[model samples]
Target: MDDSKGKFGFFADARRLRSFLRQSWRSADASMRRGAVVMWCVGLMFTIFGVVGDVLETWWSSMPFLTNLLTSLTAFFFAVPVALLVLHDVSHRMTDRAGRRAAMAVLAQSMYRLEASVSALGPVEHSRHSPTGGPPLTTGSILEAARARFGRLQDLEGGNAEDIREATETLRTAIAQWKLDRLPDQFIEEVGRVDIEIARLRDAVRPRFLQSDLEWPLDRQLHSLAEMANDLIKRPEQWTIESYNEWCDVAERFSQDFDQKSEITLLEINAVFDLLRHVQAMHIRRTTFVQALHDFNLSARTALWELSSL
Candidate 1:
C-alpha cells in the first residue's frame, strides 16, 4: 500500500500542476494566450508522436530509431508546462506595470482638476458666470468664488477604476470644506458694520491703504497661491512623499502670509478697523484653501502608491 501511494504521487502532483497552469492561462493577456495555445498544440502533437513511436517500436522491435524518437517526443511534451509557466510569469509582470502606469495617469488628471479648482479661488477679473452675461462677481467675494469653483470642481471626472469612489469622495470633501469655510455671509455683514463706524468718524479719515496698495499685497498673496496651483498641475509626476512635504511648507508660507501684518495706510481708525477685519477673513479663506489642497494631494499620492502593492 505504501509503494502504491508513492507510485501515485507523481500523478497527483501532475494534476495539481495542471490546475495551476489553467489558472495562469486564464489570467494571461491575448499574446500570452496565443503563445499558450501554440505550446499546448505542440505538446499534444509530441504526445501523439510519443504514443505512435512507442507502438511502432513495439510492433517492429528492430527499429532503434523509433525508440530514440519516442524519447525526444516525451521530452518535448514535458517541456510545454514549463514554457507555459514562464509565459504566465512574464505576462503578469507586464500587466502589473501597465496597470500601475494607468493608475498614475488617472491620479495626475485628478490632481490637475483639484489645482485648477483651487486656482479659481485666487483673484480673478471675472467669474465663470461672467462670460455668460450673468451677475459680475469679484474674486475677493469668497461666497461667489467658492460657488463658481465648486460648481466646476464637483463635475470633474475624478479617480480611476480601483477605488474611484474613495478618491472622489476625498477630493469632494476637501473642496467642499474649502467652500464651506469661506462662504462670506458673516464677513459681508461685518463689513457693513465697519462701514457705519467709518461714516461716524468721517472727520478723522486718512488713507491707510490706497485702493491699489490694499490690493497689491492681497494680489501678491493671490499670485503666490496661483503659482503653487500651477506648479502642482505642471508636475504631477513629482507627487511623491518629498513633494508632499514640500507642499506642506508651501501651505505654511501662505498661512503665515495671512497672519503677517501688511502696511495699511490709515484713512480713519474706525473705517480701517473694519477693512482690516475683512482682509483677515479673506486671508483665512486663502489659508484654508491651501491646507485643503495639500490634504487632497497627500490623499491622492498615498492612493496611487498603494496601487503598487496591489
Candidate 2:
C-alpha cells in the first residue's frame, strides 16, 4: 500500500503512469481518440503564441501593440477551448466509462445465471439414481464409502481389485449424491396424478364416427399414441430423450395429416378436430421447449469441454 517513492522516483512513476495511460487509450475508437490530439494541439498552440509574445516584447519595444495582440490570442484560445476540453472529457468520457462498466456488470451477471441454469440441468455429482456419477470427493473417501457399505468381513467374497474399486465407486456416488436435496414430495405426487389423468384420457380418446378411409388411419395413430402413453404410466423409467422426441414426432404428424386429409366438417366431428388441435398445440409447445433445452445443453457441454481442454 505504500506509495512513497525514493530519490528519482517521481520521474520513474510519471513515465510509468504515462505508459499505462498510453496503453489504455490504444484500444479507444480512432475517431474518439482524435479529441485528445485536438486538445493537445490547442494547448500546444497557446503555449507557442504565449512564448512568442514574451520574446517579441523584448525585440519590438516600439511595437507593443503587436506583442500584446499575440498574448491576447494565446489567452483567447485558452479561455474558451481549454475549459471546454476539460468539461467535455470529464462529462463525456468519464460518463462513457462508467456506463460501459455498469452494462458489462449486468451482462456478466446474466451470463453467470445462464451458466448456472445450464449446469443444474446436468447430472448431480453424486446421485444414487443418476447413471453418471461425480468426481472424487475427499481424501480416501472412496475407501471410506466401501468400508461403510460392507455388511460383514465375509461379504467381501474374495473380491478382486476391479470389483473392490467398482463397489467403492458406487457407495461414493451415493454419498456425494446426498448433496442434492429432493424437491418437495407434493410435486412428485402431483406429477403422478397428472400422469394417471393423461393415461385415462388417452385410453378413452377415440373417434366414434370412423369411416374406412382417413378416419381409420387417424384412429390407428391415436391408438398407438395411447399405447405409448400407457406404457409410460406403467414404466416411466423406460422412456428416454429419443423416446420423447419420437412421441412428439408421431403426435405432430398425426395432427398435421388429419388437418390436411380430414374432410369431415360435420358439426359433431368439429369437436373432435378441436380436441386434436388443442392436443397439437400442447405437443408443439412441449416439443419446442424440449428442443431448446437440448440445444442449449449441447452448446454448454461443447463450451465446457473446449474450455477444459485449454
Top candidate by TM-score: 1
Model 1 scores a C-alpha lDDT of 0.44
lDDT of 2: 0.41
Q: Per-prediction TM-score, please? A: 0.36, 0.28
lDDT of 2 by residue, 145-167 (tens): 43443322124432344543444
Minimal lDDT window, size 10, model 1: 208-217
Q: How well does candidate 2 score on lDDT at residue 216?
A: 18
Model number with the top lDDT: 1
Worst 10 residues of 2 by lDDT: 208-217
Error of 1 at 210 (Å): 51
* Predicted structure 1, TM vs. truth: 0.36
